[model samples]
Target: MTDQSAAPDATPRPLDHLAAMGAPDALALVDRAGALSFTGLDRAVGALARALDGRGLAKGARVASWLAKTRLASLLPLACARAELVHVPINPLLKRGQVAHILQDSGASLLIAGAGRSGTLEAGDRPADCALLIEDEAGAASLAAQDGLPASAADPDALAAILYTSGSTGRPKGVMLSHANLWLGAVSVAHYLRLTADDRTLAVLPFSFDYGQNQLLSSWAAGACVYPLDYLTARDVIRAVDKHEITTLAGVPPLWVQLAEADWPEATAGRLRRITNSGGRLPVPLVHRLRQLFPAADLYSMYGLTEAFRSTYLDPALIDTHPDSIGGAIPFAEVMLVRPDGGLAATGEPGELVHAGPLVAQGYWQDAERTALRFRPAPVFSKYGGMAVWSGDTAVMDADGLLRFVGRDDEMIKTSGNRVSPTEVEEAAVATGAAAEAVAIGVPDDRLGEAILLVVRGDPAGEGALRDGLKRDLPNFMQPREIRWRADLPRNANGKVDRAGLKAELTS
Candidate 1:
């Protein structure tokens, strides 16, 4: 990977970062609205920035967008970056209450949405200071046609976006990110993934999430064409890949599982050159199946948090030997496993994963307590002494300097004098080829203190066979006390398995 430590300081203007790459006629983005070249994208972003700036808002004011994945929504991020306004993207799946929480928390002065979405908000939901700007096709075209836009007015340290992530138990918290964070992240991921102008990326993830947003930034950094998609099913993704001849695709584990089970046309499967995954671990069984399904594509298993955008990504070359590992740090990141006492964790020891470097976010917006709990100072061994993100997720570093995700620090199952990772049990069940999806949770028990409860979604007739296999594969402590079969498991807006929702339902 290219050294990006000096990239943020060397290029303060994010718009200029894209300009220095290549010819202006290179393709940058593609959607139903058609393709946008680098020069066209720069001009459109500048025009929109001018329109937003002409609204007389103060510098660094917050601007929120709650719309579906569209060309306008895609360009708004770069527009806000050039205009020096903090962009807050709300997931289109969120309800009015959730949208209200984000607008209030971010102190957003302006809100943009489609007419249908804007009508969903109740009176008094938005802040009194906020103004509404409804985006219609005509309105967007007019805005993009404006000329004589002012130059970019942002510093590298200024807030670029506030991405609100769902908290375990409470309202979502907005993670603050700076221009340097977004710029360096785009450059770093593009460099490591080997993106080029010939590649075409299909973006299926929501722009509200950091991982989803990176799909656009990284592709643009390499002057590649990005197709923003709001797909409904695996078939939709398959059709898009076939139609566009897509070369690069990114997905979370749950989505990957759905795609692996679908019937793929041979041509579509071979069209994919690279596939990257995050949001959760790719189950070993799914990994093997994906390898067989997409023999020509390189599968990259990655791990990341919203606070740092991304931490580690396993090299595609090592997927055969280290199918379960999350690999080492990505570019411009210093990933160190730190124990609870603030010391380096020895090899094979489980500790909190801490990420330090330019990729670190600027902390949560307007939530000091939650920020303090997740973001902290760097350890004494670091080359630089700035703030670092203390990822609450637990992991272990092996002797080869590779990282393995154990489980969330808060979600570890403590039973019978032992700490067990739920992922370990869940992965073990899926590896037996009897279940499509599995979730393991600890429940109250009179004898074992806490017993393992396995929730699976697959054929009901196969439960007996799967249970028999689990008994032979797992120890007594790791075995599930009961196996519950369901038609399907719930998923959050970001498409992760809804473990939190399951626990809440059990209590209710």
Candidate 2:
């Protein structure tokens, strides 16, 4: 782990602090059309912040944005942070019910939505007191015409944003993040990544995601430019990289898979200095292929969740020998493996990963019971009764202290009374040329209580041979009872495997 003292104190407020960046004329944001310099972005954010405040909304009130990756949506977070209001970004793809749920849950006094998305809010019955601001010509003219208002001074502990999780099990829960929490997270990531003012980051992930949002904040903190690309195809990514001279890009495994197969321009790829992966681990084969493609860029395999933002990251240098390892605790965090009995696990022992330090979130919004279950005190040490996120992820540490992810605790399949990691099954399946991707689930069985079922995407003709090969790799009990091949596995909006959807398919 890097020494904390060596880390730079890069925390700054979203509004005024960022405006003071040394090179204000440097590009800060880039869209398909053009780029916004630091000075230009600050002016726009200030105008928006004033416009939001002039509408009679008080400090600490919620302001929701339901739009695509437009310049306004990109600026709203910082603008809201400046006004001391919590910004809630609704996923544009969400249905009316989901959008309404977020609006109600956040208690947003006002909503700033694009014309298309505004209908979702307008059609739904909302609180009578709530005001709506449509992001249209009229709204833009209104904002442009409005006079400036004083910036709201915010404490570091004030609520900055309320990001909603996917809520695969139930209703999405809002994750409360303070300015301090976000600032610290950004600083931690920036310090470890060694971000600089010359860096240009291509933003592909949704701003609603914690990891995605950090790409903007950390880059801004380092006075770097962020090109927000709402790409329709892999070609869009390839084009944007070359067009903007992009240096950094963050993506999930699915995006990486797509990019790896896409016809990438050598000139465009040559400009990228860094590429990051999270949401899920990049398959070892895919990681190697990416390394081969972008020989000049540093490939970062990171592991994180909304609850803690980011936990571990495998350095680019170690990708060859430890492709499976998720690496160690990032700057400002201490990650440990705790056994089921609440003791620290020995080296190479699998246990729940407990993340301690300032990076832990306040808790799940309005769900104290669930919050208590996950966030608890640090068992190994306590300086200020600090809370640790008891991540449901199972991990093992090697002698050198690098952590390898085993599986999610809830995702562990029990077959014949033995716990098995679905990821292990999936990894083995993907290793064979027969499958491009795989997911394993334990289905109900009269004899064994549960039986393993495999869902795969591959050539149908080779699936039979792949099943035989899987049996050879796995034990008799661990071998899947059923093998179903699909053209492609179902993915959620964030591009993660929709296990719930997969399970539904099995029952249907």
lDDT of 2 by residue, 270-367 (tens): 89899998877677888889998998998888888777779889888898888878999887677888899998899989999888776778888778
Stretches of model 2 off by over 4 angstroms after superposition: 1-6, 10-16, 121-125, 145-152, 382-385, 411-508
Angstrom error of the Cα, residue 327, model 1: value is 0.1
How well is each residue in 150-232 modelled by candidate 1, as lDDT tens digits?
45656778888999875544556889999888888888788788787888999998898888999988888777888999998
With a 3 Å backbone cut-off (N, CA, C), the pairs that clash in candidate 1 are none
Cα miss at 503, model 1 (Å)? 6.7
**Residue 172, model 1, lDDT:** 66
lDDT assessment of candidate 1: 0.82
Which stretches of model 1 miss by more than 4 angstroms? 1-12, 19-22, 148-153, 411-508
lDDT of 2: 0.77
TM-score for each model: 0.80, 0.79
